[model samples]
Each structure stands twice: as C-alpha cells, then as structure tokens.
Target: MFELIEPIATVSFSKVVTEAFLALGMRNYWDGYFAGRAAPLGLAPAEVVHAVFYNFADGEVARHVPWVWGKTTPEEAIAVRERSSATVLRRGIGVLAEAPGLVRVADLAARAAVSAPTEGRALYAALRTLDVPAEPVARLWHAATLLREHRGDGHNAALLAHGIGGTEAHVLMALTLGMRAEKFDRLHHLPTARLAAVVDGLRDRGFVDAVGGFTDAGRQTRERIDALTDELAAPAYDELSADELDELIAGLELIAAARYKRSDD
Candidate 1:
C-alpha cells in the first residue's frame, strides 16, 4: 500500500498538488502539505491539526492551516488534492489505469477502508464523511489515503501508550533510519535546545546513547512500538478475504511498478 500510494500522498514533492496550491496563493511547503491533509477537517484550528497530525511540529502546522483555509476553502482544497492525485496517478500508470482490474482493486480497498472503525481514528473518520470518488483511479487513490491515515492514527496511539512524544519519536526514527538528528531538527524547524533536551530525555530513558544511536533498550522499545502499531492497524484489513487480499496486492503491484517507472523517467 505504501508503495502504491506514496507518489500521490506525498504532496510536498508532487508537481500537480504543489502547483495547484501556488495558484491558490499558498507559497510554502507547509501550505500545501498541511492544507491538503487537513482539508477533510474543514477550517479546523491549528491545535486540532497539530493533535491529529502527530509528527509535524505545532508551529509548522500553525503557520499554514486555517490560514490556508483563508486563502482557499476546504472544499476547494480537497477537490485539488483528490483531482490532482487522481490525475497524476493515472498518468503514472498509463494504459493500466483504465484496466477493469483497477476498479476491482479500488473496490476491495474501499471495502476494507470503509469497514475500519472510526473510534480513535480522527483523520480517517473525517475523510470517511466525504463522498468517495466516482472515478475509478481517483477512488483507488482515495481509498489508499483513507487507509494510510487510518494507520497513522493507530501509530500515534502506539507511541502515546509508550509515553513517547512526537519529537522523541522522530529522534528515534532518525537513528533507526540512519539519518542525522541535526538534519531532522532542521527539517522539523525544531530549536536546537529543544531537540537537545528531547535527546537528553531519551538518554535518561536509556533509549539513545550520548553518541546519537539507539541503545539496545531503545531498539527494543522502538521494535515494540512498531509491532503494536501494526497490531492496531490489523483490524482495518479484516474485511478482505484471502483471495481478495491476494488480488488487491497483485493489482496494486502493477500500478506501483508503473509509478516507479514514471518516477524514474
């Protein structure tokens, strides 16, 4: 699912999504990212977006949210995300975008998505309230987005259960992904002192070493969080039969391959 949806979901680098927001008077990366994701929340306050988004720093979300709403209505923003995502996805997959099998994959994924419960999944629920796209390719992208946000909501729950804050989570991910912590701080626009403080807190918890890599305990804890997130996300896939699951994965592979080819080109 990540392979198939990432190209469309990553509005930060998407030509269509970014260009659409530029025309709408949004000039920064966050303007499109925050507005596109929060469109379903409908003129929601920055704090609400910060809470549901979980990973982005509060100030990052605050800089562009309801403010983006001021420049373009939520309906218009949602239309842009949906329309542009569908457009780009179809172009990426070429002729396969029109195959009858594409419709079946969308149908299977949508069934699983809409079947997922809304309790504790705020972002997914908001998207659920909107009409599902009628176009087959658009509907596939929409279903994938619904499922992605659904899992993200669960991921946040897993982190909170283990007492991990958002910044700390990113620090852990930075180590896990072999990325530099300083780079993460810059990307999140985190203050140096604040990031240092978060790293100190993790060190106190024995999750990270002073040298900026995960301690054995830290690795174990991160592993547990990852497992729990998947466990929480498992129920969302319960609606798919074994055969249907196989069918969907195979169908998505074709589209995913095309997207990779398109990206390469």
Candidate 2:
C-alpha cells in the first residue's frame, strides 16, 4: 500500500499547482488576455484553448472542451496552434498575481532541485531562468505550471499504454471518480448514444460489467495505470531527499486545503 506514496504525493502536488489554471480559466482578466491574443489569429476561445492546452487531435480536444465539440473547425484549431505559447504564459502570470499561496509556492519551487529529466522537472528548471515578468507571483505560477505539466504528460503516456483512448479515458474517470455513469455523456460532452456504444465496447473488453461498473479486474487495471504513472513520474522528485520530499508534500497539502477551504467559505 505504501508503494503508492510517490505517485499519490506527486499527483496531489500537481493538482494543487494546476488549480491556478482553473481559477485563471474563470477570471475575466485572464479571459481578456486570451481573447486579445486569439483575436489577432481570428480564433474563438474554444479554438484557442483546444489548440494551446492540448497537443492531441481535434477529436480528443472535442472530448475535453464541451463547447468545442461542434462549434470549432479543425482547420481553425490547427491554425491557432501557430500562436505563441508566451501569450498563455503571460495570461497565467496575470492570474497568478492574484492567486493565494503566491509567495509560499514560488519560494518552495525556487529552492527545489531539478533531480531528474522528466518533462516536469526540465520545464521547471527552464522556467526558473526566464525574465519572469518582474513579479514573484508570476514567477511562482510559471514554475508551478511546468511541474503540473510534467505529471500530466506522464499520466497521458500511462493512459495510452493502458490501451485507453481519449474519450474512453474520461468515461472511466467519471465512473471511477464516483460520478454517476449516466452523467458521463453530459459531463464529458459525448453524445449519450455514442458513449453507450463506447461503454459496450469497454464491457466487452472486461473493463466494465453489465451495469457499467468496473469489474474487480477493471478496478485493478485502473489502479495499475495510476501506479505506473506515479512510478514514471517519481524520477522528477529525485532532487529531494526523502525527508525534504515529505515536507514538500505536507506543504502542498496545506495549499490544496486552502483552496478547498476558500471554496467552502
């Protein structure tokens, strides 16, 4: 059971850091930044989000961003990819300036060692050297995004190795995360009839049962995917000694708790 410590810790850290994106995604200030940048390219919000955030196919983006499902053209998405990532980074910086835990997380990341070549660690290292907008919060959020992406990129790889496609992965996620299976279509922006077919296919593959629940085997498989993802992402934390890693995890937990606490209030 304790074998899962690294992945669990890493996932928690990633989620806490990535929460800023969600906060940023909701703010008009960040929206204006993205819209301003996208305007020059003649793309809509959905198109630019699908282009910049996800590197997969348009179909996958459709699965992730509900509004992008039928509203945007693949040609437009492809074209939006040509826009500079600096725009997103700038928007993120602006949002981070107003985020909680700004100085704390930034200071932690600045003191962290890049112990591995995992995408997250490398990105974190690179971001640390940038001009960083002359603001501590922006610098902090920038570093946090790199660390978040590292784990995320690794998770996507693990999902692929598990033979799960983009849509099916979200389906599994909804069910596994305790969301009602019936709500999967609505939540993931998949058509109900089409998602039912995907469900049928998953059932046939022994990943689900007649009632659309994970079989014991299915649960085990998902857990394995998570475990492997954690293992793969473990090297990124190699810079921290065991004690230091634990301390970092505790700090991240506090950050996450603050997020939930604020939401509750």
Candidate 3:
C-alpha cells in the first residue's frame, strides 16, 4: 500500500490582519488582503471577501461591536441603565393606569347606551391616582381612542393631524415627502381649494393655526405620528415595486379624502 501523508494547515498573516480589520469595521481593507490568497484559501474570487466585508460593514452587526471593551466607567453605565429602566417603568405604569379607565369608559358607554359620564369620572380618578395632569391626560386618552379606530386607515392621519393642529393634507404630504406643508406644496401640484379645506379642518380640530403654525401639543402629536409612519414604512419600502409605492400613495390620498368627508359630516 502507498504511504499516506496529511498536510498541516497553515494560516496566513493576511488572514489575521483581515480579521483584525473586520473586528474594527474596516471592510475596505479586505480586498488587498484577500487578492493573492483566494485560490489557496479555497475562497471564490478575491472580491468575494470584499463583498462579504461590505455586507457586514453596512449591517448593524459591525457598527455596534464594542471596540472600547471595558473602557466604560461603571458609574456612567449604571446611570444609563438606571435612566433607561426608569423610563420603561414610568411608561408601563402610565399605560396600566390609563388603559383600564379607558376600557371601563368604553364598557359603560356600551352597557348604559347613554353618556360617558361614569367612564369620564373613572378616567379622572385613574388619572389622579397616576399623578397625570387632568387636561393633558384627557387629550391623550381621546387621541388614543381615535388612533385605535383609525389606525391603518387614512383617518389615522387625519386624527393625528387633528391632534397636532394640522389638516389631513398637511399630514398626508408630510408622510409622503417627509417634509412640512409649504415644502410639500412647493414640490407637488395640489389644488388650492383642497389645500384650503384640509387646512380648515385641521384648524377646526385645534391641531394647527391658520398661518400653518403648530402649537406645542400639535408639534408633539405630529412628531409622534410621523415617527409611527416612518417605522411602518421603512421595512417594506425596499421590497415594494414602483407601482406598489404608487398604490400606497394613492391609498393615502383616498384616506385624505375620507378624512375630508368626515370633517364635512
């Protein structure tokens, strides 16, 4: 029988350097390292490693790696953790306190087939218990109800605008272009009557002023709604075809129209 021998595996200095660079999110350095070693390493074109490096570099994985390693002060980390935990706890408590009162009001409104006085009283009591200021809490509760009824529909945009002191048109344009009303109007061709109607509706709802200014509450509402729309749209945007994006825009227009109709009623 022929003698059989196994070859020992050898690692390249380039490989070590490349790994170190990758750890630092410097993917641009991979090509130079991989160029000559591709065949020996059983890697496809040297470019393959470069592509892999870019993929990791562009992704959150490489961006979030803790390079400072053990450099953070314990006190600083503790403070950050405490702040984050407190915020979460506060939000949880607020949700728990407010949600039951809202449910109770809805239940009473359904069972009594009458005014929401009992529900309002319960909500007031709950807000007091939670140490929430009365007026702001009431507005938030009302906005939450409107959001629940209108989410995923055009009415949600209208309701959000109403909450903020803006018209449905302003909200719709903001959602489409990620900009304010004047900017959106400058970029697109909207009829004056339609624009005026949307502005009027927003003003009536106390979401905006005639001069297209937002009140503090309106600004907060707009920011929240804008954030929600961005979150909802971001994941699906890359997968959507041009036609699909157009369809979505069309749907938004329909929703705007529906909001206008609601205001008319």
**Per-prediction TM-score to the true structure, in the order listed:** 0.95, 0.58, 0.23
lDDT of 2: 0.50
Q: Listing every candidate in turn, what is its Cα RMSD in Å to the true structure after a full C-alpha superposition?
A: 1.6, 9.1, 26.2
Q: For candidate 2, list the clashing residue pairs, or say none.
A: none
TM-score computed on alpha carbons, candidate 1 = 0.95
Output the better candidate (1/2) by lDDT: 1
After superposing candidate 3, which stretches have Cα over 4 Å from the reference? 1-188, 230-265
Candidate 2's C-alpha runs over 4 A off are 1-105, 110-134, 185-188
Candidate 1: global Cα-lDDT?
0.83
- The residue-by-residue lDDT of candidate 2 on 119-178, one tens digit each, is 433323333343333355444433444455455556767777888765667767877987
The 10-residue segment with the lowest total lDDT in model 1: 4-13
Residue 241 local lDDT, model 1: 88
Compared with the true structure, what per-residue lDDT tens digits does model 3 show for residues 1-265? Answer: 0000000001122244344434434343333233222212222332433332221212222222232212333233322222332333233234433444434432322222121122212222221222211332232232222222122222244334444322353454454454655456432344666556666676677766667666555566666765664443233234445665455345333333443454476
Q: Could you give candidate 1's per-residue lDDT for residues 1-265 as a string of tens digits?
A: 5555455455324877788888889987669877888989987899999999887755877878778887898898898888887877888888888889889988988888788989999999999999998889888888888888888899999999999988889998988888768776544567778888888999999998879788999999999999998888778778998888888888888888877887799
Model number with the top TM-score? 1
Superposition error at 40 for model 2 (Å): 17
